[model samples]
Target: MRLVAPQFQPRTVSAFAIAVFLALTAFANPAGATSPSQTPPRASVMTVATQDRVDTRISGLHTRLQITAAQEELWQKVARVMRDNAGTMDSLRQARASNVNSMSAVDDLKSYGQIADAHADGIRKLTPAFQALYDSMSDVQKKNADLIFQTDHRHSAKKG
Candidate 1:
């Protein structure tokens, strides 16, 4: 099936770049687990693994951005938003998983809508903090940040 891509606003692109990892990871259900009842144990493990992935992404981004001591405070705000966004996505995923068996078609669609809304909301919350950090970046650091986010945006677009 051919999928139509959502048109992303330019400002949200950077926020989406940060969120793409969480969105991708949130969909990785365990192999052979086809139902909600089969998911609890695996879900717990997946939660930890997902958190690890989020942490690794945060740390990698921080390193790649070459954040200095002076930028640490602003960086912390960005990081916190990223972490919070991941947690919000994770919770929504878990809720959907737990009730999968009981959900109607409309319920399923609404659940998905909730996830999409959360993603948009996350981007909204992330943009300002990320903009502050971006503002604090040196020219070289800004270039690095641009490359990093643009790379992610391209990768995600290709996937979509």
Candidate 2:
């Protein structure tokens, strides 16, 4: 039988990674705009989505992932990158809160650019770790890994 963790949910891993990937890209753009109010709501939704995906990934894995030294190191790097991105994410959120329901052209462009860059950094930090995790897993585990993180949120939540 295939070894799998009972609490593991492969869907979670895939979903969360995908969410993070998507949000990081959406929010990292610098050209994004809001009147200092709408950023929070946008950021909040993004943050919620980010957390959900992480939970999904962690809960979905069946195999006992051996966290190697390199993985640990990568985690630190990811953490730092996340830490760096947090402000931009928050800023974007705040901007959304300030500008909710109304989107401007010039400001959104700036904010979008910032959000994209921040997210790019976040992806740069963690995506390789995901690949590493995939590499460490057996065939079955690898198969499930991709199945977890897909979402329609990306298309629906278009960047302003």
Over 42-89, each residue of candidate 1 has an lDDT whose tens digit, in order, gives 222346766887778889888988999999999899877776776666
The local distance difference test score of each candidate is 0.66, 0.49
Candidate 1, residue 78: the lDDT equals 87
After superposing candidate 2 on the true structure, give the runs of residues whose Cα lies further than 4 Å from its correct spot.
Answer: 1-19, 22-88, 95-104, 150-160
Cα distance off (Å), candidate 2, residue 3 = 49
TM-score of each: 0.75, 0.45
**Model 1 misplaced regions, further than 4 Å:** 1-46
The TM-score between candidate 2 and the true structure equals: 0.45
Worst 10 residues of 2 by lDDT: 36-45
Number of the top lDDT candidate = 1
Distance from true position, residue 49, model 2, in Å?
9.4
Ten-residue region with minimum lDDT total, candidate 1: 31-40
